[model samples]
Structure formats: C-alpha cells, structure tokens
Target: MTHPLRRGAAYAIGGAACFAAMSALVKTVGGDLPNSVVVFFRNAFALLVLLPWIAWSPGKRASFSTRRPGMHLLRATTGLAAMYCFFYALSQMQLASAVLLNYSQPLFLPFIAWAWLGERPPLRIYPAVLIGFVGVILILKPGMGWAGPAGIAGLAAGILAATSMAAIRRMSDTEPAVRIVLWFSVLGTLVSAVPAAMHWQTPSPTQWSALAGLGVIAAGGQLLLTRAYALAPAAHIGALIYTTVLFAALIGWLVWGERPDMLSGVGGLCVIAAALIVVVMRQRGSRTARA
Candidate 1:
C-alpha cells in the first residue's frame, strides 16, 4: 500500500479495535447495569472529551458553529436510539452475535440512500440485501430459545444504526466531523439522562472505573474512526472496518469464554460476506466514476 493508504489502514483497524474493546466493556457491565445507564455515560463523557477539541482545534473550532442544526439533531436522535438497542443487544446476547447482527447496517444503506438522497442503487444491491437478511435469519434462528428477544434487539440495532449512519454520510457533505460527533454526544446524553436516572443503579467502585473507561474508550474510537475516513476515502479502507467483529470475537473468547455455536458462526460469516459484497461493489462504482 502507498503511505496514505497504509496510514488509513492502521487508523481504520486501530479504530475498529477500539470499538471492539468498547463493546467488550459494555458486555462486561452485563445485566446489572441498564443500557440506559451505560448509554448516558457513553454520551456524557464523550461530550466532555469533544469539548476541548472543539474549543481549541484550529480547523474544528470554527465548524462548531453550524448552519444545519436540524440535520444534526435528526442524526443525534437516530444515533441515540441505535446506541440503546445495540447496548441492550450486547447485554442480552453473546458478544459475537450482537456485533455480527449490528454489522448488517450496511445492508440498509442502499435503501436509505435511495429514499433520502434519491441515489438509486445498482441492481446488484438488491440481491446483496436478500443475502444479508438470509444471514440474519440464520443468526437470529428465530425459533431457537437462545436467539429470541436478543436477536430481535440486535436486528433493530442494525437497522436503526444504518439509518443514523446514512444520515451522517449525507450530513457530512455539509457538516464537519467534529460538529456531527459533538451533536451526537450532546443529544445522546440529554435524551438518555432521564431514563438512566429513572433506572439508576449505583455501581461498585470497580464498575465505576469501568463506566468511566467506557466513555473514554468510546470517544477514542469515534475520534480514530472519524480521522481514518478523513485521511482516506471510505472505498479504500471501508472493508477493514469489519476487523471489529474479529477483534470482538477474540475479546469475547479471552475475556468471557464466549463462543458462538456452529450455526451462529456460519451466520456471522454470511453477514460479513454479504456486507463485503456491498462495500466492494460500491467501491468499484466509485472508482469507475472517478476514472
């Protein structure tokens, strides 16, 4: 790889690792901590982390004052909902299953783009979408007791996250990354506060450290991810983002002795393959257009 591509790969893979670690931490909090409680700290502390950069960074500080407040608010609302579902899924299911389920976000992007931006997807996307859902069915195994409610939450998380992420892509056309990330933190923290307060559980000292660490880790992942995309075109490094799932599985096994059965493992591979098809095709089209 060329220097920039190599740098982008490092940033992207490292970002994915951070995300994997953050998700593992979320799972560690376990059922004792409500999703709302964790979501609140994830947002609140992320906001604290972003404030300094926005206040001081030469380029980003100016982007703080945005003209498109409504778009930012909408992304925040959708992202906040996505975060809760994902956290709930992580709490309820095997770490690998939850992460794999959420990976289906890419399957929804084509349809979202068509509706939101009038960007018609290539015909190939249709088949990829079907393949993706079949993978979901395999992973979900709806009739199985293990994949019941948690499976549903995981799917919902993927769809909701896809919506928010597509909107973020559109918004990024006009908005700065700092602005978008900052607003997500702001709205997520504010929106989740009441519910978290209502379902409050006092953490033990160790759990408190974990909760604080969650915020820092989550924010760090967001920063690295944002910078990665800024440094290189998504087409060049997008597939690398799936490293998070691999990293998560490693963490799940080492930290919690969690392992997916054969069926679930097959399903996860299917989802990853289908999502890769979509990404690879899209990147090809982008290159074609540029050429």
Candidate 2:
C-alpha cells in the first residue's frame, strides 16, 4: 500500500498539473478575449462545474448556508481581484514568469496574517522573506530595463492572493470549505460581469471550448488540492505545490518558446525556497499551538 504522505504528494502534484494546464489554456484564448471576459467565464463555468459536485454529495449541499456574508464578500472580492491581475499578467508576460510571481503569495502571507489576524510570525521567517524579495527583484529586473507593467501586475496578483488567503483564514473557523468556495464562485461571477459586459467579445468556437475547459480544470485542481491537504500535513506536501511552476515552465517552453534568462531562473529558485520555508514554519506553528 502506498504511504498516505506519498499519496498526498501525488494529489498535490496532480493539482499542480491541472492548474498549469488551466493557465496554458488561459494563455491560448487570452489573445482574442478580454481579461474581464476570461475572468467571468472562469467563475461562471467553475460554478457550473461545482454545482454537480455539490448535488452529487448530499451533505455538501447544506454547506452553502453561511452566517458571515461580509467575510464571504471580502474573500470573493479579493480573490476576484487577484484573478484579474493574474490573468492579465498571464496574457501579457511569459507563462513561467507570471506563474512564478503569482506563487510568491507565500512571501506576502506572513505580513497579511500579522496585520489581519494579529499573529506575529517567528523571527526566522524574515530571512526567508528577504531572500524571496531578492528573487522577486531579480525576476523583475527593473534596473536592467526588462521588467514591465505586466511584471508589476504579476506581483500585485501575489499580494492580492495573500490578502484573499488571509480572509479565508479569518473565516475558516466557522465556515465550511464548500461554503467558502461557493460564495467565491457566485460573487466572482457576479462582480466580474460588469467589466465583462463592458469588454465583451464573442469568443470563437475554439476559444469557447478552451474557456469551458479552463473552468472545469480550475475547480478540479481546487478539489485535488483540498484532498491532498486533508490526507497529510501541509509541511509534508506543500513543496509539491511548486510543481505548478515547473509544469507551467515546461508548457511555456514547448508551446510559446519562452526561456527565462539566468537571472529569472535563479530568482525562481529563491522564491520557491522561501515559499517552502514559510510553509514548513507555518505548519510547525500550527502544531505547536495544538500541542
């Protein structure tokens, strides 16, 4: 029999692959569609895909009820903003670079938690954060004249993602995962619609197909990641989440001929290392609190 940790790792990697594929699909259709439209469809189609799952699981249906509408709105709004920035970055920048920047969410998470939850992280996490920012600077290459507005947008995506995560943490005590996800999807679609309508362009047949797949894949990846965390300690499989960066890099290289320069490559490594450190430390802190 496979060890539970190994299985969890497998599931995490699988989720990473799904997300990478979803990103690639976004890049594919992004050429013709507005980012707003893409964001709207992502939420709309994800809701469509999510409904069946809830329907199939009888118990999960009741999870939709929530006492905290305000918190749900905060999470959904921030998450939607992150999606807008991330998708825009994907449309404009190298797939690998955009994905790497988005993954830097962990670098901002500590500060967000500190501000929102009044939880101070350990001193050791600071060095990792410093190293991660150094990596971010290298990737941005601002002084070298390589970084562009898209790079800023990509980094902004990370910050917004961290904020959304913090909001999720705030509500995790009383809110079920299903309810949180449902609220995000519902509010995301509704909020994205105003912009989507302003920028609507009928998608081509191929683009329509890709957009649909993007939603389904996004929801599937979320489910796989949830399962992975349920099966093992986050410290055991958190690093596996970075496989999305590797997979995105591979897809970029093959599909778009994107090759990050040496600086960007090194920076990506730094960011990944820093994120892993944060994940491990966060897990340790959780365990200590429980003990």
Using all chains and alpha carbons, the TM-scores for the candidates as numbered come to 0.94, 0.97
| Clash pairs (backbone) in predicted model 2 | none
Write model 2 residue lDDT over 1-291, tens digit each, in one string: 268888899899999999999999998988779999999999999899887766666574437678899999999888999899999889988999999999999999989999889988899999999999999999999879766988998999999999999999999898877778888888898999999999999998999999999999999998899899988888867789999999999999999999999999999999999999998998899899899
Q: Which structure among the candidates has the greatest TM-score?
A: 2
Candidate 1 lDDT, 1-291, residue by residue in tens:
878878888988988898898898888895788888898988887788777766675675336578888888888888888888888889988888899898789888888878998867789877877888888888888667558777888888888888898888787778877677777777788899999999999888888888888888888877787788877878656688999999999999998899888888888888988898888887787688889
lDDT of each: 0.83, 0.91
Candidate 2 matches the true fold with a TM-score of 0.97
For model 1, give the 10-residue run with minimal summed lDDT.
Answer: 55-64
Instruction: List candidate 1 segments past 4 Å from native.
Output: 59-63, 287-291
In candidate 1, the residue pairs with backbone N, CA or C atoms under 3 Å apart (3 or more residues apart, or in different chains) clash, namely none
